[model samples]
Target: MSDINISKLDAASADFDRKLQKLLAWNEADDRHIQQTVLDIIADVRTKGDKAVIDYTNRFDQRHISAAGELELPGEILKSAWESLPAEQAQALQIAAKRIRAYAERQKIESWQYTEVDGTLLGQKITPLDRAGLYVPGGKAAYPSSVLMNAVPAKVAGVGELIMVVPAPKGETNQLVLAAAYLAGVDRAFAVGGAQAIAALAYGTETIPAVAKIVGPGNIYVATAKKFVFGRVGIDMIAGPSEILIICDGGTNADWIAMDLFSQAEHDENAQAILISQDESFLKAVEQSIHKLLPQMERARIISASLSARGALIKVNNLNEAVDIANIIAPEHLELSVEDPEILGKNIRHAGAIFMGRYTAEVIGDYCAGPNHVLPTSGTARFSSPLGVYDFQKRSSLINCSQTGAETLGKTASLLARGESLTAHARSAEYRLKA
Candidate 1:
């Protein structure tokens, strides 16, 4: 929002990264203190079951549900929600489901068993987790996109059952999200949300069965709870605030660039929006555009705070440096607003999903980018990947061997087993060889 010079802006950008690095230097989610904490929650939920879940829901949600059965949303409500939605809205959800389902089907891995050397056979049989729980945020922000993104993949992966949970913030859930859930083929859905829903999903209640995995986006408490319950049941990732990075050339329109940055900034106060450019004049124009465009937004105060705090306009040494920095940051979303988006795209290695050209804004990725908007954030992109059909599927190794093959395989196995000093393993292999 300020008309700062390039030098000051760069210094500010450097400071932001330095502070961010310090804040996240240690991944405390894995620290022993926190590690045992999640385990305790999982244990309490697992053993006490419905009572513990109700206690947690009351304690965390600050709402009084009469009992455990009250947590699960009724099928009629979801069905009514589906029927009540505008025909166009319903159709749109169906269309999104179609695209996601088709894509997810293509991503699905079939059960394969193949013969290998020595006549031994080994392959992988891909199957879906029996049950999955999806958490959709509620209140002013209800993401229908999340339903399609999280459920369709699991559906395509052949998951036997899909359950969704969303906070009925203000004592009510959004019909749009519920409609989307129906379209996505969810087996069950509930009004219970927040950490309590996650706890219930990880550890079943009397009414709601525990799920094999949990996916979708939520607030900090939900995210922290997901981190806690991870080992008990699978979770997509430890998600953080949303972010978007753009590398722009001098040729693009400055107004478009500013609004694009605002799109991500408006997501949350903590969300980040950054622009790196080789041309200094273009960067200044973009900054000016951001200032001019600030007043036009209904959420001007929020956007300005985000821009001033987390957003930046950086002057890079060259396009190469921009790409290198982009990879290092490993942003959740990266856009090349440059002349040749494809050229810059090749240099990128660490990003959840990339958008080429100024026209492909990060907002598109949020709604219709055809990629899971549920991406790893807070630099987790370095190791984690975006949510996909693979997240919902489990792969099991297949091994079959003829008697001759077993004898030959066992001989090699015995030698390696002895090297590791596993006596039982060595004896087993030797016995197989002799047999």
Candidate 2:
């Protein structure tokens, strides 16, 4: 096997920032053709409802379903899938589900209010959506983890019903995914996928019900459909490629860091894996380890391609500089593989999820760890956050004003409304004031 070449940069170099930016750039240009195609699909689903969904599902997923009813999987099938799983697999799923549910339970928001001096009540009310859609990718890979991550949180937030849609290309379904759906307490499961499934979820079909919000990950078509139907129904953030940034102190095992980088790199050609360390010798050791390990990976070609395209091994002057670079990247997954990971983690303001300590592999968080693996990518961690129960629950401002409080608030509202030249708003507030 040949040596793998990865990008290397010195943080003290004059053009380090530019080089880093070039490496970090991920342009998700909206392909006009995809947008138009998704638009057509959405419009068709809206106009024809069940027929459009069935036709698209047949064409795209290569299925031969004659009726809309066939698209909806029987809940019994999910249970059977769960029951049929091997004892080991079933036990693993159960354990992961329990941990995820426990974490989500803590994230659930409760309604709270406080009384003011005038006995006016003011606070926020938290409510879950009536129904939510979870889109799990189905063609090449099966993501049972996606099922648990999206569904458990919604359930914890007290969402009334959770609907799941996974494409069954060639009329074949993954047992693990169905088992996960059953385990996660999905209210309904659909066998259709792609933009058609998204459209059906956004606008109710004869068999499928429209949901208040949609979550999960998908391909370009699914993402474009989500973007088109944003205002019509709430959606989780549009995700980018998976990413991992590891900051090492040149003390951890070189092979461990190499495998950690490969964990994200093997995701896809676009997935990124980077390492920042102060030890030049350690960086070389990791590079050697990459060459030694790449050949053994099942997806070696993919990992190699990803590392060549987006991966980096940087030499920083110190750990602080490493943290500074990490802040700029705001990666989806940041691993502090140093001795004092907590201290370094304290200064981290951005990053979707931080895995502290050498033993804390990012892969653990992807699976059984108590946090949601669905996270903001493409530098969005700077503002966005990981998928959690909070995403499933929404807040409404609560206000119950006493007569005196209304009079006092009315004066302020009247002035603000009048300043904006909204006579109706001004009069509406003035009407609530004491005569």
Candidate 3:
């Protein structure tokens, strides 16, 4: 009772719920405009093919390009860009790429068709896509990491061809990004981006070949395009703003937690970084840490806005209460930086990924760790999963019924089809069972 009394539990439950409904949430209306644009762009690209892509590139990119073939990013640019990366940046990219590739390779699954207990051979054949589109976002932030996170998995999953479409805004693609793409062993790289690039990938353009699936993070525009084109082509997930949730108690230091929160907040103004603490004193300390740390950051304005607007330093009744809040949030990244993080980590059911202990940082997982950084956001973690080698893979059910097995399965199928009032389905099953 004494501990709970000190927390911020005043008559603000309704207000908090309203804020929660607004923040830590995604807006459907915002995507409608983007969807319309993507649909029009997809239609234009489909009708005009390469010409439409080139025209959109020139119009949107402000480039002086005339033909779609001209929009095909030159190989020499990647070659020179790869050669020009500073030794340190180049080495860092290689190290991260290696780690991502190794992790993704491990996630690759093989097909398995096995005999069931009922004498029925039922299994799925895991196969890779014929081609996949990888969207690497370059606006607001340069995510060379996005390149490896999205493409390496496809490579490991044995996707036949991996094409990259990066929205190089202002007619620019960073050298480090190109280097990352090169090192990741991308099959094709194009300069066109945004909803337009998604259109080219979803529908074939003469210059840009179509892909069976698209993966990676992007702006809302890119996410909307992915959502609109899902039926025509597969997408990894509609990633929203970056999100991180940290749970702490009395034993943890506030400064480290505050810094971790800032890392995600700095990514964008809409990004969410939350700290759930059992101790009111601990929460205050973290607030101070945030104040102390904000002065030194280069992106302090963006971080401050995100924290004051959407970031939460929640004071819960106990560790269990903290865990409950975290489960509801289903944050993209979850960290347990308590005295016994491993013990507390077991309570978490819905998170894209979990980082345990004070020594483990979210940035570690973002860079060199053996897990994926591409994760579900905006509570999608409740049902979805992180981007993995499986995203680029396809599955085919293997069905080969022996004479006896066919008789049994055919009878069951006929019964189900008849129950569902599908005479054609029942007749097909009857034919299989016929003498």
- Could you tell me every candidate's TM-score relative to the true structure? 0.90, 0.98, 0.92
Candidates in order have lDDT scores of 0.79, 0.95, 0.81
**Clashes in predicted model 3:** 0
**Candidates ranked by lDDT:** 2, 3, 1
Distance (Å) between predicted and true CA of 370, model 1? Answer: 1.4
Off by over 4 Å in 2: 1-3
Clashes of each: 0, 0, 0
Give the per-residue lDDT digits (tens) of candidate 3, residues 103-140: 78788888888886557788889989999998887755
What lDDT score goes with residue 337 in model 1?
87
In model 1, which runs have C-alpha deviations exceeding 4 angstroms?
A: 1-44, 55-64
Worst 10 residues of 1 by lDDT: 3-12
Q: Tens digits of per-residue lDDT for model 2 on 149-220?
A: 999999999899999999999999999999999999999999989999999999998899999999999999
Instruction: Show model 3 residue runs off by greater than 4 Å.
Output: 1-23, 28-35, 116-120, 432-435
Q: How well does candidate 3 score on lDDT at residue 227? A: 84
lDDT winner: 2
lDDT of 1 by residue, 178-279 (tens): 888877788888777767678889888787788999998887667778987889899998777778888888788999988888898888766788888888
Q: For model 1, name the residue pairs that clash.
A: none
